[model samples]
Target: MAKYGIIRMQKFHKDAITGIQKHNQREGENSKNKDIDSTRTMFNYDFVNEDKIKYHEEIKKMTATRVKRKIRNDAVLVAEFFVSASPEYMHAMSPDEQRKYFEAALDHISGKYGQQNILYATVHNDESTPHMHVGFVPITEDRRLAAKDYFHGKTKIRRIQDDFHNYMNKRGYDIERGEPSELQHKSVHEFKKQEREKELKQLEQQVAHKEKEIQRMDSFVELKKAPPVEIRSEKRIEELCIQPIEIEAAKTVRGSKVKVEETDFHELLSFSKELQQTLAAEHERTNALSREIDRYQKENKALKHDLKETKQELQVYVAHQDGEVEKAKKRMREKLVHDFSAEQKENVKDEVKRELDKQYEAHISSLSDDLTIEKQKHEKTKKELVQANKMNDSLTKMNIDYIENYVPKEELDKANKEVDELRKENKTLKAWKEKALNWIDKHVEKIKQVSFFQHVGGIQKRNKRQDQEIER
Candidate 1:
């Protein structure tokens, strides 16, 4: 038989355990160190009973300190029930099944109240009745208890009992009560079992109804007195039942219905044959469509790959073009420098030539002045020569007369020496004039072959090109 109970535990300290032990000692119970099973303890405290102490220790280990203390308080208020079996009721379950049932019950409660509200739960066979002691915290983290708000002065406990009964009934258990109408007396397991049986019966009836309909249709098809038409009229009923009802619902729906004349049976037969042929043709067409879709998908994938490759190739081409552009720019820069240097050289040569021309012109002017002075000196020398010649003639005449009469030898010798020295001076002047004319000839040749003029044409061409470029 299934038993029911609620166990409430409360937090206690070391002092409380000590006090309890002292009270038990006074009552003549030897609460000394003993080898008891540690699993029996509800709270882990240093006590004489090792079993009880270890049991609490395990629970404490599984829970956080705050939650453990809360559940400890809840465990203290639990009440166990020893339900009996009779002809008016039945055993809800055996001891083992009761354990499972209570475990499920506890899980359901935990789900409702939250796991933090429950500390621990255990089945105690040592007790008179095989019952479970469920330990829970009365106060939630938000400081509320289960069913307190809804139940407040109402039959909230009854509601919990009903829900629990329904749960057990669904799991295939028995119900026990004085009368079938006394739902209050029925266990949580019994109520759940009855509800589940009703649901199962309803599901079975639905399945049976569907099966009968299918059988009726199959019978009608078998009894048909006409030849198999190529154009079948099953378009109206194709979706009725190919697979199970659930699978049928998931498939796509085809077209809607249309009215056909029944009086023209021959035409109807002919149309049916045509329809069957059309359906066969459509089946082939659908298969072909599916193949086409697959082919298109493959082509799409290939196109995507080709597009990626083309993009990569384009990128490479762009990079190569960029490189070529850079090279062209570099060449252009170098060429600009070379052309500028050539132009500068030509400009320097022109300036040098101009300066040389100025120097040459000044030299020519000085030469002209020297020539004028030389001509004046030549004229003066010519006049002096003529006067000398006249003087010489006159002197000769005088000398002859003097010689005939009686002249001095010393004076004649001195006159001959002075004449020879005058001749030598005249020859030196003629040589100086020839040297000056030769110097003027060399200067004229140097001016004619000026280096600046040699490159002037080329420099002008380059400058024009540069100006054109700037304008552009």
Candidate 2:
């Protein structure tokens, strides 16, 4: 079988980030895809980042500084690149080789859209196919968040596949490129429907064939119900025997013996004997036919029971599959609705924030203009006041006596009392100063007397030392 390297890209808006994280990271329950084998889930690994990457946070971090403007709610926050090869190709490779294959694919994506843009490169081994789920922030080289810039048109999409295939081939993978997605790709629902239809058709054919066989057997039994050839021959002989006797009776007188030829009598005797043998053979054949019919009927009944059970089993299986499909659809529908609702809310919030920012900026600008005007007016008033002061100064520095002549007597008395209190404080400070000086003088006299005594004692000790030296 020809093996192909497969690469598919799916865009996820900001609102869908959480769901993508849940699916790619295998968070929560495995309700999304039944193919997930939890036993093999431990083998799942990230080829890019070893650490568990929170997709929402990673996208936010990528766009926080780069994307200056408020992000649109419908904007593609992340693009997951599904990288895998055909089952034959993947199964043929060793585990280490598979990891290298994924790593090479990651390098291709990272090279195209900087390694920093990769949020996560998780390879899931639990699913039916071993594929890498790469989360990428679609940030352009100019530091702008735009998924369309990289993956927008059909031409670009095709080029993406071409490049990936070429890149893988060059790296020695030797895998064929997959068919055009538009031509060969089928939705999960359509694929399942086709498979189900095929199974049901085969079952129908089986049942129809069995029914035809039963019908044919029933026809054979009905045909067998007629008497055998031997029995038929016996009936013909009896008719012949009666017809000859009737002809002879017409010729003979009443109550007279119908005299027949000896040959005819012998012939009649043989016919009677043959008739007895035919009847006995027919009786045996009839019994055998009845037994065969009974066996066929039993077999036919069994076949019909089997067909009915098969149909019932098929019905139950179909019901279960349908229920699972409906549940998946319901979950998908609810998730879509939630994502849409969240996107709409985020869009509304962003729009409101933008409007508010504009209004605030305008308000601040207006206030700044008004403040500037007020500052200018104040400056002018200040200049005028400076000139008035200059003129007043030139007119006369207000004579101190003239200004004092208007003083209230009560205020003057208050000022006089403050001066009197200050004088009392000054007198008290003088007394404390005199006491401090007298204490300093007494301590200085005591210090001088002790120094003089020490000097006398030193002279006496020197004289004693000189006397002792003279004695020695």
Candidate with top lDDT is: 2
Each candidate: what lDDT? Answer: 0.45, 0.71
Which stretches in model 2 have alpha-carbon errors above 4 Å? 181-472
Question: What is the lDDT for 75 in model 2?
Answer: 76
Off by over 4 Å in 1: 1-95, 141-151, 176-472
Query: How well is each residue in 280-399 modelled by candidate 1, as lDDT tens digits?
Result: 677676557556656655655555565556556555545644564575467557545543544477899999999989876765665455445545654665566567657656766665
Q: lDDT for model 2, please.
A: 0.71
Model 1 score (lDDT): 0.45
Q: Candidate 2 at residue 13, lDDT?
A: 69
